[model samples]
Target: MVSDRMNSRAALWRVAAGQRGYFTAAQALRAGYSYQTQRYHARRGNWLAIDRALYRFREFSDLPAEGDEQLVRWSLWSKGSAVVSHATALAAHDLGTANPSRIHLTVPRGFRQKSDAVILHRAELAEPDVEDRAGYRVTTPLRALAEYAADGEDQDVLDGAVAEALEQGLVTRRKLLHAAQALGARAELGVERALGAML
Candidate 1:
């Protein structure tokens, strides 16, 4: 019995280590923790509740909350469907003058997580439009720019993003044009104007 308990604890640690010390209830169950055991751990202060279904190892409480750690946590809470996007993606790519007060996440059409700290957009993102950054999924530079333009972001910020992406070779005129066209008329026109100004 003691060996089984030790193995379970080891498995849980392995899962939590990769997720900034966080583990979901589903993950806990998969790691051999019963619901009653989870409740006992929380009551004993061995686990810190991050949300309704998420818990963190108290032993890793010293881990600094920096960089994309929070984003990764939220993505895991979202069951791996959330993709960082919009102004947040622009900031991630270092291509725009975007300063978003809230983290932006793009999920699939049926996603439903409501939180004031996060702005969630629902859309179907193709594999090419998403890229992994710092262990978190984020929209590509071109997709970020197009989404920002579609959302009616500041003209100056959009322009700066275009110039930076072009200069960094993160995006080309043709790719930008294709992305803009995919967003329809207003976005296409805005991206065109930004590209024209850069040339």
Candidate 2:
């Protein structure tokens, strides 16, 4: 008979495989496995911890290629409040050349962080300012650029993001000013000035 530990590990493996190498403790618990048992197996080399509260099938990484699903899973660990922002957002919008070293996330004020790879910031987001992009809930292009400005993005980056916003007609100077006021001390005049130049 397979021992309970082995059985739980098998279950974890199945779930992690379905989730593209990443599964959270809550997900495993929902799958009729014990979180503590899963941790024990991970310590024993049966599983690998990825992000905080996330585990990956160790063998999955040994495979020859990466999958879009893995990126999606990492994004999910951030919950719905996070938007792929900063350098990543610029890449997404095709507005800049800088590649971010970490996964930048513009999160709401009260959301908790669950991953070391995520660089999180607090922001006030309105419902219409957010939309789904590639299975991740992200700030709209204009809102993302504004948030980037609020977070003190460099002049070139700010200019690129603002230019994209203007091209898309998603933001106006009035909108940025309102957002800047809401951003308060977190707002950077550097971003605001660049955005003004675009206007």
Candidate 3:
């Protein structure tokens, strides 16, 4: 029979071996353990709870602590169909500021999640309209910029994002113009013009 210490070690190992650092209480429980047990181990320095049922490896496991990027990643894990959008996607494209506090996530119209940090947008996504950003798949550069510009934030921020996007070669003038035209007369013309000026 396995001792409590051995079981705790095994559970910790499971968390260390997986690509995911976050695990729900139900997941830990289903893995032949209890949530309280996991908590006990964490209290004993065998693990570190991130948030909710989410956890990370103990310091001795040599695993890095889950940081903002990891939280964003966890948010993605929680949202299987979510695509990075708006400012989050713009940042991913290196077209805007970095490490936004409120991570923007877009999923299909009916998808939802439990995260409050995520600014969720329900929009239709075409397969070709997305791309892999630093291993996290997100909306394409042009689409991301367009979405942010349309979000009705300060127009200057949108212009800067579009400018950076063009400077980084993540988007083309023609693409931006076409997208603006599609968005019609109500679209932010300044941001579109910024795109045009760059190309």
Candidate 4:
């Protein structure tokens, strides 16, 4: 029984490691924690309940966490179907001029969930459009800027972010243009306007 418990802890740790120490109740159940066992662990302070159906290990972190934990939480909350996007992705790549107050997430076109904490964009994404962040996913810099333009974000912010991304080698000029062209007329025009101003 002791060995079984240890093994469960090890498995749960592996799962939480990829999520900045956050895990869902479903994950705990899969890790061999029964409902009663979970309650016992929670009461004993071995696990800290951070949100509805969500938990973090007591020893894995200090109080007052950072943005990475928030990203992990929402990614898990979306059942891993969403990617950090728009202004949030721009900020993550250090490419934007605007300090957006809300976190942005991109879900599939079929996704129907709503949340006040996140501004969600719905579209089907090709595999190459997403970049893995170890604990979560985000749109690539080129894609992020293009999506911003497509959505009619402030042109100044788009121009600044695109220029910064290009200057920092986060995206190639050719690929940036190509992605914009593929997004739509609005996105392509916005990108063209930004690039034209540079010349």
Candidate 5:
């Protein structure tokens, strides 16, 4: 026979599985773990405390987290309102030489946040601008390029991103050209110059 305790643990495991073995205290509550039980698990080493309200199964502590896991952690931190963008998105798409020192996240125009680990861009993103990644959201390569050009990043960096994205077939030339034109002058010029040899 199955006990309710077993059922609750199983339920929480299901949720944790989807989050790389991580979960929030509120999520534990929804999985039938009371605050007292949550405390007990943390103290007993069944759960590893990650932040003020975040945790992961202790079993996951022994292994290294994947790159995308950072995205998930930040997405969870933002309560799923952030989309990885800019140089980070460029790297995610594997089309640039950008080595972003901080994670770049795009949040709603009204969103306000502060963190040394992240650089937040505020915009009301259109649906097509974002793409659902493994367990998080990221700006599409097209959107990423437009953002990079608009940000006026070093021209050399922009050229590298555009060239790699085109050679790797990550974005169609016509689509990229269209995206750049829509973003206005400077962006269009960057894409144009990058496409020089390819054109």
Candidate 6:
């Protein structure tokens, strides 16, 4: 019985191993931890609460500063339904001149969680518009650019982003045009001008 309990705890650690040592209450339950057990661990300083339902194993509290683990943690907190988007996605893809202070995430239109640390946009994202970046889901570079442009990002910033994306071959002209068109008239006009300047 003791061996079985130890194995279950080990399984929980394995589950958190891939997520920078973070895990959700639901995952802990699946790994045989009751709510009481979870609280005991937290009280014992073996786990750290990241949010209402998210936690990190104390052993991995010293993660590197440069990785997207926090973003991935937020996405997991969203139950995998949100994709990093807009300026945040631009930075993730390294395709644009974006430097967002807050993480931006796009969830389906009905997602209700709100946080001061996260900028949430509600939208329906097509599968093609989403991609995996460092294990986190994010809007593709062209899709992110179109969304950023449609949201009235600064013209100079938009232009620079478009130029950099084009220069880096992160997006082709046709795909950019298509994404722009999907964002409607204002975005199309802006993208056209940016493309013209690049040409």
Per lDDT, the best of the predicted structures is 1
lDDT tens string, model 4, 1-199? 9999999999999999888888988999999999888888888888988777788888767756665678888888888999998888888778868568888999988887777899998888888999999678999888998888888878999888888888888888788888988989999899988887677
Screening candidate 1 with a backbone cut-off below 3 angstroms (N, C-alpha, C), the clashing residue pairs are: none
Q: What is the TM-score of each candidate against the true structure?
A: 0.88, 0.62, 0.69, 0.90, 0.87, 0.91
Off by over 4 Å in 3: 1-20, 23-37, 59-77, 98-100, 133-135, 182-185, 188-190, 196-199
For residues 1-199, what per-residue lDDT tens digits would candidate 3 score against the true structure?
4786577557755754553444545556666667678778668876666776666555423655443345345543553577777777767666656446787887777775657767888878888888753325678888877776676665666777777777778777778767766655545475566555555
Candidate 2 segments whose C-alpha is farther than 4 A from its true place: 1-20, 40-47, 58-81, 86-88, 111-118, 133-135, 168-199
Question: What is the C-alpha RMSD, rounded to one decimal, of candidate 1?
Answer: 2.0
Which tens-of-lDDT digit does each residue in 61-132 have in candidate 2? Answer: 788754245445656587445766656666566664546667777777888665667677666667787666
**Model 2 global lDDT (CA atoms, 0 to 1):** 0.66
How does each model score on lDDT?
A: 0.87, 0.66, 0.65, 0.86, 0.84, 0.86
Error of 5 at 3 (Å): 2.7
Which candidate ranks first by TM-score, i.e. highest? 6
Best-first order by lDDT: 1, 4, 6, 5, 2, 3
TM-score of 2: 0.62
Q: Candidate 5 clashing pairs?
A: none
Better of 1 and 2 by lDDT: 1
- Model 3: lowest-lDDT 10 consecutive positions: 59-68
Clashing pairs in 6: none
